[model samples]
Target: MVAPGTLLLLGPLLAALPGLGQGQGQGQGRQRRPPPTQSPLEKVAAQEELSLPQLAGKWFLVGMASHCSYLAEHSHQLEATAVTVTVLDGQSLAISTFRKLDGMCWEIRQRYLPAQAHGRFLLKGRGYGSKVDVVVGETDHSSYAILYYQKGRSISVKLYGRTIRVSDAVVDKFEQRVSAVGLSEDMTYYFPTYGFCDSADEFHILDETKP
Candidate 1:
């Protein structure tokens, strides 16, 4: 029972209405500081001198923390998710996420275009679709990865493991990052260890590819 809010890996970018207003409105006769040039998500540093090839392989989506209302309400119905990352043309990433929706395995494909920064990427939506900024905050190239996704002002942090289970130390690190982003432990949800789907048939694939 996936939430109508979650489009699997796409998160709120695919479900929520486009152009939702963000930032605090300035009241009449009240002075407000100018906004920073970069967003809060952009301020978070990416893995320095990241090697994209090392990130290629199957990874289990073990943890996620987001403030999307639908996900917050239906967090318990989260499904087991897995992703296979492939480096395309030596820079960009071709990602295929597998999960079960209504008991049927499905594949969701996405491409992360490299940004000016080494570990930062961008997922541009098609047509009226919204854009998502992606950053690999931390990764050891073997054991675990902590990634951040932001669309507009909403941000979601994800913890990926080389295997289904990661060490408690890693979980602690993930929680710390989550809290740093103003979210609490209650907003974090862990995926199931079992019932992971390796692949999905062609008919069940949702390709978010650029023409």
Candidate 2:
């Protein structure tokens, strides 16, 4: 015949032992669990709200500005003759582009961004001996920018215009955003390959609203 107080203490201890063992088992089980599998850009893409149709079509490399070595030397030197982006059943995207640099031409093809993030379409490709991540997108109705991350190392920013050219104020604002993103301005260069203008020098702004 045990005292009521003694039984109460013993009962609590016995009940706690099973809970302690279960916790330890769970910890060990978690330790043995495999790491999550995800694409290289999955985490980065998850941070933005991107739309689907906005990513379609050929986005020319109108400009490139960067502090990185490869970009500093050859920024804006490469002109994208053609860019073809297609969305597959709203799940994935396929991209192909033809670019010319120093009289040499090459083609790039890639598949990417089954999931959208931020306000851009993200895709990855390989071209000119480097791995490139292509972010073709628009930040506003009047302006857009494409970021090409090369060699998995450096980035090149290309600004675009909805009309013949971007306004000075728009360019200024765009540059500010670029700088805010931690990119250098001195290393930046411009490329005006296609759209409303034929020659690079013709890359001047015109008011499209005036129709």
Candidate 3:
């Protein structure tokens, strides 16, 4: 089990249930609170001059934040995550997200439009009959990167490190970038590494690819 010290749950607070063996006065659980809501923002502008080829390696998800929306829904159950982006022929990009859920391996695949401009691309598939716009705000081409995506009110901010354990300085840098993008610092959550990739072929690539 992941240690409570390492698990960071941002956004809305979970339901406050009573402690497992508490005194009679402490047995009552508090009423659950509702999650916050976020209004839609204006069109998101992309960063300039991103080299897709350089981002084509594996990256681990270290932290994430989002606007007050369902943007983080698909990712909440996921832990120990990694992403691999490969350029296939010309400007077409092959993207993969690898994660583990309760000790089970899960993956998703999506393809981007051929014309990616200023680090902006429309990804047509996101596992489960979904689509999204991907914006890479900043990346060092290695070490760490900040990724953003939104479709309607669902906005996501992802921080990727070369490995699971990055220095606190790196985390601070990512938080700055997140604030620059208009997200609250309290919403940012840090992810832990479990190193759960069973094998090279363990990642389940979505069958949305053309033969």
Best by TM-score: 1
Q: For candidate 2, lDDT tens digit of each residue in 99-190?
A: 54454444555666542434344444333433345554334523454443433444455565544356687677657646654677786677
**TM per candidate:** 0.82, 0.52, 0.65
Better of 1 and 2 by lDDT: 1
| Better model by lDDT: candidate 2 vs candidate 3 | 3
- Whole-model lDDT values for every prediction: 0.89, 0.51, 0.68
- Give lDDT tens digits, candidate 1, residues 129-209: 478999999999899999999997789999999999999999999999999988898889999999989889989998888
Answer with 1 or 3, whichever has the higher TM-score: 1
- Which lDDT value does model 1 have at 77? 88
Listed per candidate, the RMSD to the true structure in angstroms reads 10.3, 15.8, 15.2
Task: Give lDDT tens digits, candidate 3, residues 123-197.
Answer: 775355366777777777777778787765567788888777777887887788777767887677777687645
Worst 10 residues of 2 by lDDT: 202-211
Top-scoring candidate (lDDT)? 1
| Model 2 spans with C-alpha error above 4 angstroms | 1-49, 102-105, 115-138, 141-143, 146-156, 162-164, 194-211
Give me the runs in candidate 3 sitting further than 4 Å from their true place: 1-47, 68-78, 114-116, 126-129, 198-205, 208-211
